[model samples]
Target: MTDSTSISLPADQRRREFIGGAKATFPLIVGAIPFGIIFGTLAEPSGLSAVGALAMSIIVFAGSSQFIVLGLLAAGAALPVIIATTFVVNLRHILYAANLVPKVRHLPQRWRILMAFGLTDETFAAVSSRYLQQEDIREAHWFYLGSFCAMYGNWVLCTAIGVALGEIFPDMTQWGLDFAMSVTFIGMVMPYLKNKPMWAAVIVAGAMAIATAALPHKLGLIIAALSGVAVGLSLQMLLTQTNTHSPAPDKEPQ
Candidate 1:
């Protein structure tokens, strides 16, 4: 009895952590549903079959990249061009991985690989928030797994629904469901703008995105992201140097 109890304790704790992670991600999941459905609805008109659309959701599982690919296909882009464009668009994941390295560095190779596969914008936002607040690190990956599974399952399911609706309605995409995702992105970003550097990065990125909106193959987004990162880093360094060089105030008499 004692041995069985001991063996079950850690498993129970992990289950709780996983459930907690999924619960925390529920709101974000709500925001992504319409986006996923929209992608499904657009896929067929953009030259993809229903099976292909569902497969992309299950295999590629990247909403933005999938949408870009659909547009490129509709435009009759070359295969290499489509591949290159998606690669450039996904470069932001590198920065996300950099921010998360220290937290997951101690994990084994298999664990790290699984986490990398599951990393998405929503998962990153949800998991990073949990990591920041939670003191215990031992079971955190369970929480990550939970969030990943919830989002992944939701996306695939929503894609299927959209595909069905596409056949039935044939005008579902015209309803403007993509706007929900834009609002969801804003919700994700607003919480992180607690400092000057963050604010500057967002403002610069937004302005640059608009200014360069006509660039081909979505290169404007990459340029805007890079510009924002550069400005933020430069300002952070300058502020650190200024604080280091400034003289201290005189103390009161001891």
Candidate 2:
């Protein structure tokens, strides 16, 4: 399960995988639509032209960083500062990529590149669950593709709708649509709290976020994320050590 090469799949299964991924990603997509819309709604008033907003949605495609970019633009932050801040906010994606590289390392260069472009928090959540369950993981990339495409397409479409409605509802961004994404993430993560390390990570991260909320430019998010990662890693190391040192369970006599 640790390493897999892309294997030829039967056509029907490929279709099934793709469709399955889309379905798995559907709820998150629904949750994200509002966030995407709010991004477009805020972008114009935040000093980005309509074309610029749409381009950022398409090119950047990271919702958190997009919002940060818009805020920094509106505040007249220098270009280097904006870039550095956004980069820091998005450093989590590097963790995501590292987690997935072993699963897809043997795929074609083009396939790897495409998946890299399509990777997102939502897609990673959905596809990582699928990859863990599927023994025939070679075809799981198609599922990833489906989830990524659905999210990407949904974001583009929602951005357009928000842009068109931006004039009609100048205060749409203030309506609190972005909170749905938080609910969606909670839903996604709730199912994965299978061990102590995960619970510790979640608890520590939440506390850190609240404690650091006043920090500027979304630094709280990065700090909380790193704190959570550290807690999880330390707990896992302790667990590993405990398991390695403990005596094996006694075998029952037949």
Candidate 3:
């Protein structure tokens, strides 16, 4: 009885963690539904077939890059321009990967690759929050897998729905549905602004984004992201040095 119980416990724990991760992502999934549908609605008009749009959602699976591709196609951009533009837009993923590497380094390469394919803004937010709370959870990767599957399934289903509805509505993209994603992003970001470095980074990024809004191919976003990262790193290093050099408080009387 003891041996059987021991053998079953880990599987049970993994299942629970997976379910918990999926549940945690419900709100973000809600926010992304309309955005996915909007992309679906825009796909045909942007010269992509329904199959192509769905394939992109399945293969590329990056919401921002998919949207940019559609826009570039609509603008009649060259194939290389579309590829380069999407590549630039997704450079932010490098930062995400860097932050996660330490935490996931022990996983097998196959697991890491699968997780990387599923890493997105929503899954990253959900997984990172959990990892922050409990860094050594043995089942954390299952949680990440759950979150990824939930978001992926939701996005694909929503896109299909939009593709079907496009024939009926034909103007669903203009329904102002994409705003939900902006609100969702704000919600995702607001929780991390608990320190000076974070606050400075966000402010600088926001300001740079606004000031450079006129840049072509959405290069302003990249500029804003880099500016914020630089400012944040500088402030963080300065604070670390200050702490290291500061005098220790005198011990109370021995």
Best by lDDT: 3
Residue pair clashes in candidate 3: none
Per-candidate RMSD, Å: 1.8, 4.7, 1.5
Number of the candidate with higher lDDT, 2 or 3: 3
Tens-place lDDT per residue, model 1, 1-254, is: 36898999999999998998898788889999999998888889999999999999999999999999999999999999999999988888888899889989888999999889888999999888988897888889999999999999999999999999888988988898878899888988898898899899999999999999999778898899999999998998989999999999999999
TM-scores of the candidates are 0.93, 0.91, 0.95
Model 1 alpha-carbon miss at residue 113, Å:
1.7
lDDT of each: 0.91, 0.90, 0.92
In candidate 2, how many Å is residue 16 off? 1.4
For candidate 3, the TM-score is: 0.95
For candidate 1, the lDDT comes to: 0.91
RMSD of 2: 4.7
User: Of 1 and 2, which scores higher on lDDT?
Assistant: 1
94-169: candidate 2 lDDT, tens digit per residue: 8899999999998999999999988898999999899888778978988998899899999988888889899899
